[model samples]
Target chain A: MIILNILFAIAWMALNNAYTPVDFVAGLLFGFLVIIVSRRVLTREPLSLQSWFTFSARRNYPLLVWRWAAFIVFGFWSIVKANIVMARIVLSPQLRLQPGIIAIPLDITSEIGITILSNLITLTPGTVALDVSSDRKTLYLHAMDARDPDALRRETKQEFERRVMELLP
Target chain B: MSLLEIVTLALTALGVLFIFLSSVGLIRLPDVYTRVHASGKSATLGVVGVLLGVAVYYVDLRVALEMLALIVFFFITAPVAAHMLDRAAYLTGVKPVAGTAPDDLEGAYNRETRSLR
Candidate 1:
């Protein structure tokens, strides 16, 4: 493979009628592509390095980038909405509130995913991620006003958790 | 003024408003945990808004990237800080206000064993 790459690079430089460093680097890149393609064609099998170096994380980089943009936009709008809600709660003349910790079960099992979910929860209005259960099956969150626990749980799962799962997983 | 200036001003105002509201929540809320909610969430958003406003006003790629980096850093750090603060407050026996229901972790701690039950 090394010899093939070098030979292809030399051929590329000859064809281009240039032997400069930049042309050599470009030839090196072109050689890599030629080797990859010829290997696939000659062996009738996928490249060996493909299996080893294929990162699932990188497979959808463009998609992830777009989704990340969406997440940021959504997060910004949610922040605005949360701010308004919090302001209402704080500025209310009655001081009517129903604050408590609600245990939300986990669907995102990865450590990074859970961390993100918790961070997002804490940053959103009305909710603070207090602690993760010892078993890691549950996330305990404190809400400033969870008048209807079931609805809150549903909203969390549908909105925050779902989007986070899509993003991380 | 131009539309961009108007939008930047609006964003700045909103950001400052959220920051101010955070202080209000800090003063009005009942306990340490709730106060963490106010400071953690509102303050982070407020700073983001303010940074975004500035970013828009400048309209430069470098400025936008810097603002984005700042926002991400704030997002990651704020919650961890809030969690640590709440955890410390809880371990130190800071109780919630009167009639704050659903104390599920009430018996989850085993002080003698020095571990969570």
Candidate 2:
């Protein structure tokens, strides 16, 4: 497992085009830093092989390839949609915005799953993830044009949560 | 100015303007909750604009790829941090904007008849 982690770290650095001698030193330093930090930060439970595999495989091979393909298509579409929405808001005469925060219930229990969902929401233009409940059961999102909060919840649940569940395990 | 120079300058100016607005909004917004909105959203867009301008100026694969990575990392982390801050505020009973309408969370909680049914 440690070897796998090191190899993954090396691959990540290489992918970032950080392969010089100095970069190699920096990567080693970063690996050491991650270990030190994880020792302190990861106290809830020791990660098992299953968990590690789950985390690694999501990046390598998703369980639901079709869902991932859809996500890639949808993700690009969302980016275009976001740019349009942002332009409209910035250029609008009245700037008639109704911003509100809504709480979304999360079904996925894995930390990685939740983290991915939060990042996905943040990357999208119209919404931002405001918080996660301490119990990790609910996520708070602030939407720029929250016409109906229920619709926002359903949108999140359907668009992100369902795909995440399919991808994670 | 040449077209390339003009484009570069325009993008750089807009990027800097966004950064400035984000900083000002961070200060001018009413509360921490609102400030998060200003800083997180505006700054991400601001940095992306700056990076895009840099990519255009450099026009090299390595620099452009690095800029892309930076944008992706920024987009991923900014909202997660904001979410943490907002949740902390809410749990501490920070006052929300007054006279807001349609709190379904409250309605649902009130409608529940049994705690363990």
Candidate 3:
């Protein structure tokens, strides 16, 4: 489907005689619209065409790509904020802290999703996903400030876990 | 001197600050588990910021691509590395600092099968 999109984009460019990278990107967008409009026709064809970018048949590729890119950008922003928080903690005079390991029961079963979730947790400042249950139903993580584990759990379940499930499942 | 130069400098400085604080956390934090937070996350972020600054300053496609690749690689690997260190520390009985509690993972590890319960 991507190849088809690029081909369509190239054809559009050729027709318009607009050859800039920006124009190619615009052509790609137009090609995406074309693909969406022609998806049913494409799917009815033989196995060869259907096999191309197989996910496109079952899922909206544009939405998936958008979510993924949004997650990356948002994740980067969170890490920057986390660094500042860690910096404040480290630079502070008092070392008074309450730390503990908490288990977040896992709803995401895919190994890849679990892996990504754990890594995201690790990146978000204070939490490190130490391990998961053998049954793969729970994730064990260490929190730097375990003062409010309930709130933390609530936020994580609502935010990170849901997002991971969306990305993979 | 110029807007681009200023942005590059700011990014580089931010990266350096995070790296420095991570080092401080390494020295100040109580245990290995917590220390991993310092070393793993902030250091990676620092590297990311620095690389991004350089990429922005250079304004070359090749350089930007290389820097982006490095950043993505770091983002993927650093957390896994930290988790490994943490798991190793726990399995070896490197207990977390005092005041740690709710060991949900306790007794989950079996020596014979070497698998979590």
Better of 1 and 2 by lDDT: 1
- Name the candidate that leads on TM-score: 3
Query: Which candidate do you rate higher for DockQ, 1 or 3?
Result: 3
DockQ for each candidate?
A: 0.54, 0.22, 0.75
lDDT of each: 0.79, 0.65, 0.85
In candidate 3, what are the lDDT values of residues A77-100, reduced to their tens digit? 778877877888888899877888
True contacts kept of each: 0.55, 0.21, 0.79
**RMSD in Å for all candidates:** 8.0, 9.9, 4.7
DockQ-sorted candidate list, best first? 3, 1, 2
Report the lDDT tens digits of candidate 1 across residue range A1-169.
Answer: 5566678788889999998767877887788666554654443545576743453443333345567789988887877777778888878887877888777888888899899899888878788888777666788788888778888889889999999988775
Interface RMSD of each: 1.5, 4.8, 1.0
TM-score of each: 0.73, 0.61, 0.86
Q: Which ranges in model 3 have alpha carbons more than 4 Å from their true place?
A: A1-24, A39-58
Q: Sort by TM-score, best first.
A: 3, 1, 2
Per-residue lDDT of model 2, residues B24-76, tens digit only: 66655445655666666666667778888888887777798899899778777
Model 1 stretches with alpha carbons more than 4 Å out: A1-66, B1-5, B110-117
Sorted by lDDT (best first), the order is 3, 1, 2
